[model samples]
Target: MSIFLIFALSKINYARTLIYIFHLATIPAIFAGAALTATSIGITGKVLAEIGKLSAKEGQIIIGAAVLDDILGIIVLAVVASLVKTGEVQISKVIYLVISSSAFVVGAILIGRFLSPFYVQLVNSMKTRGQLLLVSLIFAFILAYIAQVIQLEAILGSFAAGLVLAETEKRSELAEQVFPIADLFVPIFFVCVGAKTDLSVLNPAIPSNREGLVLAAFLIVVAILGKVVTGLAVFSKEKLNRLAIGVGMIPRGEVGLVFAGVGAASGALSPATDAAIIMMVISTTFIAPPLLRLVFKEPTGSPQSVSSEQ
Candidate 1:
């Protein structure tokens, strides 16, 4: 993190002023939409439910943050495509991206917010076969394909599809059916991420070739801090512990893997960069469950906590 760099230099107590000035000037140089893309799927809500902790107060907060993080990512990625073709600065991109992102957001919002619910309601109103499962998969794939057509990630489309399913009256039935399928493929995504590493890149043997390392370090920081900041959105002055909620949302699961895979596919990521990215993903995922479990644990004799504790 350049933010951390400022602090690190502060510890040396030498010419910090110049460093801060340069840093301040350069921050405005970042690509806003690209910078805003989050680390990826936090332990999505279904994970918490399977662990039997969804009802806990803290679990609810974690799930809320994770959901918000996903929402922020969708908006960010939609905007990122617009900003890229026209490499404007962050401030300018903000305006252009908002307008660009709107159509995608509105379209998704219509499906997620209105159509999916109505469809589920209509389906529930029927006594037909359980082909709702097939219908949903078709919808997910169609949206995924559309996301690709728009120069966005298929995962983003899938997530939007997920949100629609989440809001539907068939949420329970749909979740029960789809989660088993997600469970099967999702871990493959993660394991593949771990598999793609070229350890030689992460090696410090060629310290002279430092550019890849620099980019890796910068991107990892963005990946973590961006999502963490968004996770804090789950709280206000009167509600959940914002820090805990944010921390719980820190783990980047399938989302990060998909990002790395995409970057590699795009030829934008080098071998060393891929290794570094995989390491970052592993760290976040390893830390998340334990941190969440700790923070979400309630004091003794609490029935709600007991019932929800995994």
Candidate 2:
């Protein structure tokens, strides 16, 4: 929804500029779309844990879909970033990226499933006791490198590596070993995202920044709508609470900020546009969690009333 809305809004606001120089308009629009691509599983996961619903069916669906959503987001980013550099949205390129990224993810899981036994055997044969952990990290990095080599996002490779690792019997042990490393690094990443954001651009006192503030406000509405609409995608396999699931998917959090930061660094997002994107991220992050908790509390409430509470 953000992608479609931002692209439509961009055309309205920047169509003349786009006509004169397509790259100028499209890159920023791409940034807007990219910013909305991924959800922060951390936020959703914490909410689920807090509600004691982590083991519930809705939780399982949300968590599972979120991983796939992240993968798809990376693929979208790769395709859009490629378009920015090339200054054209080539269908062939998009198709290739879609196929390659999907194949990479699916292939990794299928191949990993078969090779997991051999991997276990190999790990046992190694003389080093801690080699399993080292191997897993190396594997993720190697996949990241390979992804870069293939003109895809490195996250694609790393995520695939993770999927592969997940199939192994040692996944729980590996996760335990890696949890500390994640705790160490994740904060630094968010810090960098904050550092890159020019808060001045969000200041309403500045006449020039007001436009971005307006855009941010508009983006916020669609961002919420985009995630909320995902509830409709739920299969009717059981009497599931779709509102709670959709609300669970609402927070963009760190992942959106990360995308915005990267776009700024790459020059795809102008300062004003970057500020708008950041605000969009912040709005969703702040709004989604509390609203999610509320909707979950009253799952049978009308959508109108549920949304009004937010």
Candidate 3:
């Protein structure tokens, strides 16, 4: 909602005796929305861990909501990418895309639910070392591939795979083995993303890049507000530090960067626009942690966290 409102307001042409801008800037609007839709799970999780609140009520809420946010972000990315690829923004087409993407995710999780027990049993019966971890990874990759084939983002499939694995009794062991691999590869992936960014686009000396900077400013405002609003919407019997959760969700970290990188690679976003997205990511990353620390400095000591009973 924030992204759409900001993009629409930014391109307003009130001088023409109208309250809105023309549809000529549709692609840019999509890119702007896509850039703001991302949230950095890595950063949010780390902040929760660093503050020793991962098991706390507010922390758990942020973690669960952040997972959903990431899934939604990827779905948004797929929709925007499809729009750019088709070069048309028909409302019907968009509706179909959204429904399909959502159904695909839901279906994967449902299927995984029924099959997970059998899958775990099969893996346990295997006569191989690291069978559980190996099967878990293969399942993730397979789901990812299926998602791509079905026009949804691969992240959706991986997330579904995670859902499946979480239902298994060996989740702890799987995490033990998988954490090392993730720790090793995740930094390498981010390094590659950083290396691909063209810094020249951000240089102020370039007169053409100035417009993107203005757009970036607008995006930053909306991005911050969008997440903050999420924090405030925590409805529970136990009082939660809503502001803290909101700030916790602020950093776009790697997710924002990945979306911008994909946009640039697909030619859906111009160099200047990509630079703007990168700047927004950097600003949010630098701002969110300190703000969260400040908000959560003294625990409110709420009676209950967000539990299943709630």
Best by lDDT: 2
lDDT of 3: 0.73
Clashing pairs in 1: none
Please report the candidate that would top TM-score against the real structure: 2
TM-scores, one per candidate:
0.67, 0.84, 0.82
lDDT per residue, candidate 2, 1-310, as tens digits? 4323433343234323432433347567766766665678989888777766667788887787677667666666666665566666678987887788778778888988998898888877889878888888888999889888888777778878998998899899899999999999989988888787888887999898877777777678767876677665565669988888778887888878867866787677888788888888888888877887777778655564444332
The residue-by-residue lDDT of candidate 1 on 1-310, one tens digit each, is 3322322232223113222532322211222213223333446354456446566565676665455545665555445433444444487656655554556556786857767656766666767676778778878898878876875656667767877777777888887887788899978876776677676676566984464555456545554564455555443455554555555656766655655566555444457655555666666677766665555554334565556654
C-alpha lDDT (0 to 100) for residue 202 of candidate 2 = 76
Candidate 1 local lDDT, residue 188: 88
Off by over 4 Å in 2: 1-24, 233-237, 300-310
lDDT per model, in order? 0.56, 0.74, 0.73
- Model 3 lDDT per residue over 177-271, tens place: 99999899888977886777776776678897666666667668767987787567666778788888788888988888878877777787777
Ranking of candidates on lDDT, top first: 2, 3, 1
Candidate 1 minimal-lDDT segment of 10 residues: 24-33
Which regions of candidate 3 deviate over 4 angstroms?
1-24, 236-238, 298-310
Ranking of candidates on TM-score, top first: 2, 3, 1
